[model samples]
Every structure is written in C-alpha cells, then in structure tokens.
Target: MGRTLGVIAATIAAVTFLTGSQATAQQATSSTLTMQGYGWKLTDIVGVYAISPSETYTITFETAAMKARYAPYYTEALKQIRDAGIHIEIGGVEPVDINQCGPKNHIQVTERYRPVGTPGWSKGVPCPWQPQGLGRGGLVIYNSEYWDGSWYISKANLHNTIVHEVLHAMGLNHPNVDLDGDGTVEPYECVATSYGNKPIMCSPSGGYHTSNMGKLVHFDVSGLKALLANARAQGIS
Candidate 1:
C-alpha cells in the first residue's frame, strides 16, 4: 500500500480556475484583488510543485505519445516557471514513484487522449498536501479526446489547457472570483486585461488563446513566484 497522510485531512482537490469549474476544497487563499474582472488570485499548495531553490522538478513523460503531444507546451511553460526562480526540467523516465504523493521528487505526466463522453479529460494531480503546503512532485494528465481530433477545440484552447493542468500539477489552484459579485463565479470571472487575457491557471479555461501560445500569464507567474516565496519561508531551499 502507499503511504497515508495521517492527520492532514487529505483535502486533495483538482483545480482549473475559471469561475464556473472545479474544486476549492482545502485551498488556503483566494485572489485578494478583485480588479473588477482584472485581478489575480492565489492559493496555498500541497505537492511536489515546490521543493527548494536548489532542486529542479525534473518533470517527465510517462509515454512517448504523451511526449509527442505535450513536449512543446511543457517546454514553453517550464521556461517561465524556471525563469521565475523555480527550478524545473523536462526529464526522461527513470525511477519515478508516483504512488499518490510518493517522495521521489519527480513529476510524471501522461496524456490518455480518450474518446468523447469518456467522463472527461485534463486532470492534474499534485504531490503531498503537507502541513507546510509546498510542492514536492506529482502526476499531470490531459487525456482529452481532442488529441485524436475527435473533439474540436481551437489550438489556443488546447495549449491553454495543457498549461492550466500542468500548473495544477505544479500545485497552483484556480484563482477565479466573482469580480461582479454576481453571487456565482462564471467562466469569464477571473482577471482580464482591457483586451481580454485571462490567467492560463484560470479554472475551466482561459489564457492567451488568441495566439495559440498557451503560455503562463503575468497572474500565473505571480502564483509561481508566490511558491518561491513560500518555499523560502519554509526553508525548503
């Protein structure tokens, strides 16, 4: 059997931050800046998404299919996260122990490319949710039927999806909020510049979809920077 969390409550939840999607189970914070639809939100992490300043995440592909599908996006996303002072690398498969918050300091990602109506796709599983709430490593999946061209979404949406899910794996949750105070968080709820750019980490779906870049936005970078700050606080690095 895998290890147990004991008293941690294991509030392990999945996130994709548009206002109308996913979980908010044990997240410790929210976007304090409700910029009238132009703000950023944040959360406390509990996975291998962070370790210390000295260590690299070394994310890897579980299969060649997954590699072929997401290597480019991972390359784009990791560079931003890495540039922000968090160490990360696209690694080859080695001895990864992905048994529900295993302690191997590795993140393994796989794309299932399932068929339509196959429950769903695009899931991110971050590592241990400890009392300290820092990233150690975990698994990320974007097993959507869209990969096979069965589901039709724009390339921009696809790129944003990968970036969003991976951030979840890196331990960042959706920061969407009710800027309008409409009593409900809608898909368009999170931050948006005057030109309409939402955080890639926005739940449900949002990002630089106009250009099909699928890279992290400024708000997303703030979250990663927050991770580094938290890591420093906990003396991880």
Candidate 2:
C-alpha cells in the first residue's frame, strides 16, 4: 500500500494540469481546498488529517426546508460513505443563523440557483481563509440551479455534487489526471474505469452520469482509506 501511494503521489505531482484554465483551476485562490495535486492544505502527501473515528461531523443545510427537501439524497450519500466501513457519523438538518455560519467547524450547505456557466455554479468551500484539518469543518454551496427543470443537470448529478463537495471539505481534491492526450487538464479530466469516466473527486464536472451517479466506486473508497491510514500512522487513533 505504501508503495502504491508513493507512485500515485509522484505521478500526480509530475503531471502538471493547465493552471488557471479550467473553472475549478481558476478557483484556486478563493477556495479552502486547492486543485488536483495539492490534496488539502491541512493534510500531507500521506493523506493524514486531524480527523478521528469518534468525531461526529454535522452537515447542516442552509435552511431547514432545503434539508427536508434533500433528505433522501443526503441519506443515500451518507450511506455510501458509511458502507465503506469508515467510522464517520454524518447527518443533520438545521438552519444555521446567517451570522453564525462563519465558524471554521460550522459546515453548512447553501443554495445558489446560478446559471450553468457561472464561475461558482457548483463549487464549495468558498472562503479563501477557511479552517484547516478535520476538526475544522467547511462549507458546501451546491448549485440549486441543477435542481430546477432538466436544463443541464439531474437529481443523480446533484447527489454526486453533494458527495463531491462534502469530500472537498474533508480534504479531498480533484483527481485531476490528464485523461485526454491533451497537455492540459480540462474540466472533468480524470481517471476512467470500466464502470465510468469520473472519479468522485473530479472537479467542476464530475465523471459519473445518471446511470452510475450516487455510487461510490473503489477509487472513492481508497481516498477515504488513505486519510484514515495516514491518521493511524500518525497515532491519531
């Protein structure tokens, strides 16, 4: 496992993505989580963060109504993570005071029904100087635009969007590989598998579509395990 991680790290660092080109890449400055190669500012190359098994991270919604509305979607997303055998209890439905939503550990999800081409259309962790590490949670602003009629996205897309953004808060970055022969990493450029095209961490636009959306592939689980293993190695458990 150590050998494999070493290879992955080296390969990721070696392949340079086109900086400031893709929408997600352009968001480098304002977001808490960096793009592609730089996993999380709080975590190391080994994928260790300040997270722990006993910690119960609360994922509150921008409004209680939104939470209730998206309840089933959230449940399915949580089930994917929990089913991976990772010890993390994640579920909550509370309307945080607009003023109180600025805390580091206060993880809230907002709704901005922006157009598809907008810069932050489906982005998360908007704050530039957000808290680092596991103990200090983050924010996720999903594009409610996707929830409207089938202009661009579907419910499955929205579900994956939730998982993707939440994972970013947990210190995951886009697995931005140069899938195409092109020298630059464009939007949705990630590893392809027999199952589908996108890894969950793929940015701006993720890989899976309606057919396989909301499913956690092996690559996704591996990312989580990488964090836990690194934490364990550091005697965090």
Candidate 3:
C-alpha cells in the first residue's frame, strides 16, 4: 500500500521573527541548502528564509470550504519539502478572484472539479518564471464543478499537485529516466524499479491513465540532482 507521510508543522516560533536589518544580514550570509533524497539532489537559490518569510508562494482557492479541506493536504506536502531541506512557509488558503488571475498562466478548474466531462474543471498553466520564459509560473485554479463529479479530486492528488508545483518553482524538472526503454516516461509511474511507472510530474491526461488521486507519485531524484547541479554551476545556489 502507498504510504501517506505525516505533516510537519512549521517552526515559526523557534527564532525571533527576523526583519529589516536582521533579515538583510541573514540573506547576505545564508548558506546554500542542499537536500539529497530518493537519489535526487535539490538546492534552493534564495534559501529558506526568503521563500517562507514573504509567503510568496500563495494558494488562492475557489471557495472557503475548499480552502479548509485542502489546507491539511497542503501542509503535508509542504512538510515533504521541508524534509527535503527546502524551507518553505505556506500562506493561509484564501478565495481566489478570477479577475486577479487575468491572463496569467494558472491552473484552471472546469466542470465543477469532477471528471473532465463534468461541469467543473482544473488545469495548470505555465507561469512566467518557467524555464526560458516558456510557459511557467502560472496559477492553479480549482472549481467545484470539477471536484464534485466523476473523477473526484482526492487528498493525495491535491497534495501531489502542491509538491509538483513547488518543485518547479525550485527549478526542478521531470526526469528523463524511462527504464523500460519505451522512449517515454508514463505518468504516475513508480520510480522504485527499472520499470519506470507513471509519475505525477507527467501530464495528467497521459501515461498510466488512472484517476488523479490514485496515481502513486514522488520525485525523480536524478532529475532533481541535475537541477541542483545546474544551479550550483551557475553560482545561483
């Protein structure tokens, strides 16, 4: 059975809230953070303090109820990032105003949050910060129409989406490891063996073709390592 890791609460009170002079000093002197897990090496350029303090990575939900339901899963996913040595502070979930998103590439929910055919829908768009200015750094919007119908969004898929997007923000990419020599990595594939199963990083509509919540997913360690090495080579981390 797939294991659901427990969440780790943020250690906000341990240190005096650093601001102004102290914050600047911390930024100037902070060391590069490196985490080695699942054979992948991940590094952060701005360090932990910058990412968490400003709470720059915000999640605006479609409704108050959805925010409450997804918050715990989001917390759990953030804990995984923390475990990976990437210090990230999650902002409180809030209702998203469609006007605020404008034309920015963000996750869109259709159908009502049910299967694609239902009245709700959900999708991730490329944001500006994406590599090469390519589609990246977009918003992920979820609607009730999509989540309440066929192919309901589960806690696992919601949690996995958070992890996947955060990793992207950190400059990681989907690994190029397709052990079966099939010339492609199936979505939600297991990374434990040479078989190369589906991964959450893969396109939601492609690969193993399972319900979003049912796919067993995790990071591609080697791919994460390559990202870290690249950042280090560029002196960004």
TM-score of 1: 0.75
- Positional deviation of residue 51's Cα in model 1 after best superposition, in angstroms: 4.7
Runs off by more than 4 Å, candidate 3: 1-56, 60-62, 93-121, 129-137, 143-146, 152-173, 188-190, 193-232
lDDT of 2 at 19: 21
Q: After superposition, how far is residue 14 of candidate 3 from its true place, in Å?
A: 45
Which has the higher TM-score value, candidate number 1 or candidate number 3? 1
The top-ranked prediction according to TM-score is: 1
Error of 1 at 6 (Å): 19
| Candidate that would win on lDDT | 1
Provide the TM-score for each candidate, comma-separated: 0.75, 0.66, 0.47
lDDT of 1 by residue, 105-193 (tens): 56777665551123334666566554345566766656556656676767787788777766766666677787899799765578776
Global lDDT for candidate 1? 0.60
Model 2: per-residue Cα lDDT at residue 199 = 67
Q: lDDT per residue, candidate 2, 1-89, as tens digits?
A: 00122233343333342121223323322333322332222223323243444455667776776777655565655776676544444
Task: Candidate 1: list runs displaced more than 4 Å.
Answer: 1-51, 94-99, 113-120
Least lDDT summed over 10 consecutive residues: which range in candidate 1? 1-10
